[model samples]
Target: MDLHYVVQGNGEPIVFLDSGGADLRDWEFIAPSLAKSYRCIAYDGRGAGQSPSPIEFGDYVEDLKNLLDFLDIDNTVLVGHSIGGRIATDFALTYPQRVSKLVLIGPGLTGYQFSPELVQRFEEIQSVAPNVEKMAQLSLELPSYQVVMTSPQRDRMVEMTKHNTLRGLEWQHLWKNLQVWGELPAIPPLNELRVKTLFIIGTQDSEDCFRIADLFKQVPDIRFAHIEGADHMPTLTHSLEVSSIIREFLGESKL
Candidate 1:
């Protein structure tokens, strides 16, 4: 698909994938910091930014595979947020040999089924919103969505979020995939995973996030960090600490 990206530094490749509704700019705040120590590569997922929109989620995975192949990146620590996390897990499961490690930040896994109320609310906000101004206002004002934005990040987030095509996301398909794949539980499945993993979740995120993160308590060779006072999008809310945590984790757990 010839996706575009911003590559910085030169060392171990750490691919940072943003959550759905966000673009590569989502990583702009932290990529430079991470680049100081590792090769930081951040790109807009297919259908998000400069990348071409795909027919399906599997197409997104194929896009990632092709990007890596094109770059000759044989070993990488796939860092993903939300849906990006789901993709990373799926990639690791399907091609274990290529992944060096995994880091999920508020990863949207298929663990807990989305409540009907939550799904309806999300659909209303994403699809049925009467206008962009209303959607932007609602997103910034709502507690569930506010955690990811500060005064600075809020402007950029609004810009990127508005780029999302409400119809293309197919909320039903996303919900169905969450139910199916999350049910498999990536945390437990990691026992079969030969690589190391690190999961970061904000304390203020959804209960479902907390519940799924809890499932990883027993998995060996995995480290979990809770960023206090942060929400689903800590990369913007707590960039300094988030970047520090990731760098330290990578340094300590280098393979």
Candidate 2:
């Protein structure tokens, strides 16, 4: 596979999917801790980091499948954050048997409608366009990132996001103009989710993230947890807590 991926330890496989505008390194804190117990694979999604850009809208999902196939993984545990959580959810819904358990941190839902204000915020970011530095600054200014913006991880978050924006704008501009992605397979309703899941979010996260958490209530086998004093980038600020919760959820699966 052309996607850049990192693998560690050895046991039941655990693949980490990261948020938009951030690469596999976003999982730097928690993935290694989990790797000590179970095999962990963290990859830069197509167009995000070292991976090349996608030729189509839904390539992220298929690229993930291909990555697993390349690694000879029959099934795996998925750990995803933000948009990464959205990808993981879509992957599980599309290939139920391939995912054993899910750990989604402040995930985004494919079919869910976002609020006008949040939508406008992103639109403003896009309006800046070719000025990637301004685009990157506007992105991190969202209240959803307030907590992490004030934390020690602030610099790292800024660096990764700016780098992603610089490398990805061209690809994003191409696909956003084509708009063929909306024609892809529809995501089933939240209740139709088949994989057992652990949904965690920071209490300080945006209202929309909490709203999405409420939506997960439709999934029968889901559990919820909150990390105190954290916002969207808990993997950077609350690594120990995130890792511990994931380990507890997986329980005896670590062989």
Candidate 3:
């Protein structure tokens, strides 16, 4: 695949998509554990980590399709976090047959309207411009990161944020706005999400996250989960819990 990716284990496949500015580092704790029971695929999206920068608006969903085609994975589990969740959501909506199951963690929707406060906070972070350090610091100033900021994973999160921030800036406008990928104008209602799904969010995350959770209720076959004491990056702060939740949802499928 053109995107930098790692595959592990050998059971049912599970493709992982990280947050907007994060890389495979977000799943460092959880993916390895799950790798014991499920084949895991984690990739660094364009302009993040080792992945090459996108020269234009990125078709992340299409990129995912290419990756699956490259790996010869016909149908598998889809696990996405943040913007990655948005990618998975769109991909599932566009190609439902390819996803046997779907899991979202603090995901952004394709056409969902974000709160003004959230928009402003992000804008403030961008106002700092090319000074990626300031941009990275402000990006994590949201209420959602409060817990992780105080946890042991704070340094790792910070490190990844800073590094990715630099990479994003280096991509120059090719990265586009972090909000929207190359999404179709129309996003099918949650009621149309036919694949079995699991929606997870941190108890301390943004209001928009909770709002998204409420929307997921329209899905006929979906489970909702919460991570207490976690904000945005629960995969880093509560890896074991998240892993266990996923394991339970996915059941005992093995090699």
Write model 2 residue lDDT over 136-170, tens digit each, in one string: 99999998789889989999999999989987885
Tell me how many residue pairs clash in candidate 3: 0
Give the deviation of candidate 2 from the true structure as CA RMSD.
2.4
Ranking by TM-score: 3, 2, 1
CA error at residue 179 for candidate 3, angstroms: 11
Write one digit per residue (lDDT tens) for candidate 3, span 1-255: 679999889899999999988999988998999999889999999889999888887789999999999999999999999999999998998899999999999998877778879878877887797998899899888888999999999899999999899988876675345554233465457788899999989899999989888877898999999998889899999988899888889885332
The global C-alpha lDDT for each of the candidates, from Candidate 1 onward, is 0.74, 0.88, 0.88
TM-score of candidate 3 on Cα atoms, chains taken together:
0.94
Clash count for candidate 2 is 0
Q: Model 1: how far is 206 from its true place, Å?
A: 1.0
Which runs in model 3 stand beyond 4 Å of their true positions? 175-186, 253-255
Better of 1 and 2 by lDDT: 2
- Worst lDDT 10-window in candidate 3: 175-184
Which residue pairs clash in candidate 2?
none
